[model samples]
Target: MEDLTPDLGDDRTLLLVDDDEPFLRRLARAMEKRGFDVETAETVAAGKAISTARPTAYAVIDLRLGDGNGLDVVETLRAKRPDSRIVVLTGYGAIATAVAAVKIGATDYLSKPADANDIMNALLAKGDALPPPPENPMSADRVRWEHIQRVYELCDRNVSETARRLNMHRRTLQRILAKRSPR
Candidate 1:
């Protein structure tokens, strides 16, 4: 993976924002090893401050921060540095959010547990390169679970509201939501 280091790549300053401290630290180290000067923030406010203080050449932001959506940081970065390449990484991935990220100025959208090499590839891809389809598509059960979780989050984790919006029984939604995420 070190071979992917951008010797001449425009990866000078990289802003990494995510609420997951462990993930953020690990990713920051990985990016630093890849020849990027990594700057990190655990909250949206900190991220916005960093971006405003010193513009970065590239950014890798989580979809949800401790305080707000990563889209907010994306917008701020785009406004401050229009040329900066920004990628939104999230554990909660959905078609709607992916579209919103792109429309909000994210160069790419990636699901979490992503490796440094994968993130680098996404950031550096030329127009000719397109993201490959999932190696193993989600099962129907997994898809349903993910959709339910997404709706649940959108409803602010209100079981009744989520059930109402999803047209599902409250108890059924509760049981499903209580279970762990599907592989």
Candidate 2:
């Protein structure tokens, strides 16, 4: 057998896992510019598979993926590379998920729309200078609405199926979908 992996040193390597291809590509480029040799995966399976071979020295994982939640990926990275610094990013910012991500070994949790600077700062911070807290925390209703919208999108905008999957009445799902997104 041969070691097929590239010779990127741990200090210069980064693993970035996210479902959004555009975001993943953009971030990978930005991180590479910052001197890391970036490796990326868009699903939990892919992320886990990468983790199995050689643990990354740094990782930035999305909190939500098309296939599953990102915390599971974070856990795997933590197990594979206990010394790796991990950051979890999400579009759906929720207190519960942030806490969960941290507890699962993420060094930082950032909401989506985060620029490369924000991510880089979080990834590079040396256990000092706390990141600014969200000015407006997401309300429970807003979080619920976002989850419903995500599921609806995942179900290809099928109201009936989205409702069924959510175990909510179709009419209620329709009403929620019809309403404007909560702040």
Best by TM-score: 1
* lDDT of candidate 1 over 1-183, digit per residue (tens): 237476536548999999999999999999888889999999999999998899798999998887998899999999999988888999887899999999988889988667887788777676647655545666778778878887888899999999999999999998998899888
Candidate 1 regions with alpha-carbon error over 4 angstroms: 7-11, 131-183
TM-score of each: 0.73, 0.70
Model 2 residue 170 distance off true place after TM-score fit, in angstroms: 15
Candidate 2 lDDT, 1-183, residue by residue in tens: 543233335487789999999999999998887778889999998998888886789899998888998888888889988988899999877899899999889999887767776777787777766766555667888878878888898899999999999999999988889899888
Stretch of 10 with least lDDT, candidate 1: 1-10
Alpha carbon lDDT at 35, candidate 1? 81
Instruction: Identify the candidate with maximal lDDT.
Output: 1
Q: For each of the candidates, give the backbone clash count.
A: 0, 0
